[model samples]
Target: MDSDRESNSSSSSTSSSSSTSSSSSSLSSSSSSYKMIKAKVFIWVDSELKDIYKIDEKLTWVEQKENIVTKLLPPLYKIVNKKYSITNRKLLKMLYGRWRSRHRTSNIKNQGDERVKQNKRRSSKNSRMQEKKKRRAHATNYLIENKNKYILRYPEEDLVKILKDSGYHSEEWEETDPEEEWPITQSAVVEDDEIIEEAIKQKSSSIYIHNKWWRSPALLRLLHDRIDPTVELLKKKPLTLKRKRAQSSQSRYNTSNVPPIGVPSWCLNQDALEQFNYSNVNIPVYDYNTDDQDNSDNDIEDENNNEEEIQNRTNSS
Candidate 1:
């Protein structure tokens, strides 16, 4: 009985130790479950706070900050320490403000970038247009310079072509060609004759005002007016008056009293007077003498032919 009592007491002591260890294990398990539940509850509370504290939806930067502060910070605060949680909120707000400011600056810079690109594109397009205009202007100048070589050489045709090539409308040149074709409607011939007269006046040989090869109408007219008085005086009193004065004495002498200047008395014979007399009348006498000789020869031939006929008639009778 004593040994059984000892064994029962020892069994009772082991049962008590086992029961205490089991109770301790149960307490530890319940504490772990409570901590897990608290962690879950804290996470849920953080999510709710994030939704409640969100800033304007348009301000996504601020919204992100609120999410980081509320949803993401609490867990980190628990791991780091509870004392830093208050300080983390202030730091988070400051960082979010700085981030927002930087974000706004970046947005402004992006707008400036777009404006610069647009201006560059516009400037490039304007420069290209200016270059095209310059090229077209050069082409027009070249055409105008070469207009004289046209097939028609008509100013109206040339004017129309020039206006057409220069980008002007046809209506702008509607009257240009016709106007050139009938340049002076009322008196073209008169104008042309006037031009010819002016040209002739300017082309005088002895009229050298400036010794130039050509002169304008204005210059030629000035020169003519300046020199006209002297030319008129020269025409009124010509150099032929001196020759007439010298010949007056020669006509006063008779033909027989005027001997030849260079004649020698020994060489002067009657043959010269006869030769002179014959030579002086030779042309008139030869002209009349040819007709006289021709009439005498015709009369002799007629008498001879009449005598032959008379003799023949006598012989036949």
Candidate 2:
């Protein structure tokens, strides 16, 4: 009875230990699953290492970056953790902003509004004509405004460099308000038009100007005036003055005194000229003698008879 009690106690202890081990393993797995559900990290992972990992929410920025680096580059993980570091807020904001920008989309309603605007632009003729008129007006105004001040139209970057090279500081220019320096007004436009005309008149005397200034308003106005005159001149033939040849007093021959060559007597006689100028020059004459006429008639009859015989032979064959 004592031996059986000892054996039963041993078996009971072993069974309890096995059950406890299984329950502990189950609890650990459940705790890990709960942590994964709570943490909202959506990082891309390698297929081979796609296992869920436990992350601490209270980790420092540097610790988070290190963690990310470790996960992404495992081979260099140890080196980075030991040497590299980054602030938590900056890294988080940077990554979040980048991802959001890349993945963000516009609403369908906004896209529909844009499509409607495009369709209206395509279908309206009045709108297109108005746009063209506006463009021409703007171009004309631009031409008038920069007539004498074309040199001042350099790009901001180039202007800045030029100012620097000339020992002029930007601070001085910035301190002086443009309104105070040159007040703009309605009369400025009128003044610009007058200036453009004056500049065009001045440029008319010069043959050429700098290529950069070729498209200036003054030049355009000059070209317009020049083109009209040229077109009108082209419509009419140019007048050519007939220069008289001066006679030489010492010369032996004189064109005025020279006489024309005379025509031959044969040329003057029309009937004789026509007769000799033909391909059949030999004229046929009828003989008055009866013997000669009879011989001629006989020859003609013989030719007629031969031609008839040849025709009959060809038809029969």
Maximum-TM-score candidate: 1
Model 1 TM-score is 0.16
TM-score of every model?
0.16, 0.14
For residues 1-317, could you state the per-residue lDDT of candidate 2 as single tens digits? Answer: 64454345445544543455478569879867544522322332223234633233344435655555555435323332353342444334544443343333222224687765544433342343343233333332233232212211222232223222311110100011224333333333236446532111111111111121112232232223212222232223442322122223422222222111221221112343353342323331111122345555654454355446545765788
RMSD per candidate (Å) reads: 62.2, 48.5
Q: Which predicted model would earn the best lDDT?
A: 1
Model 1 regions more than 4 Å off: 1-59, 79-86, 114-317
Off by over 4 Å in 2: 1-83, 106-317
User: Mind giving the per-residue lDDT tens digits that candidate 1 earns over 141-235?
Assistant: 33223221211122222223322331211000001121333333233234644652221112111100112212222222222321222223222
Residue 202 miss distance in model 1 (angstroms): 64
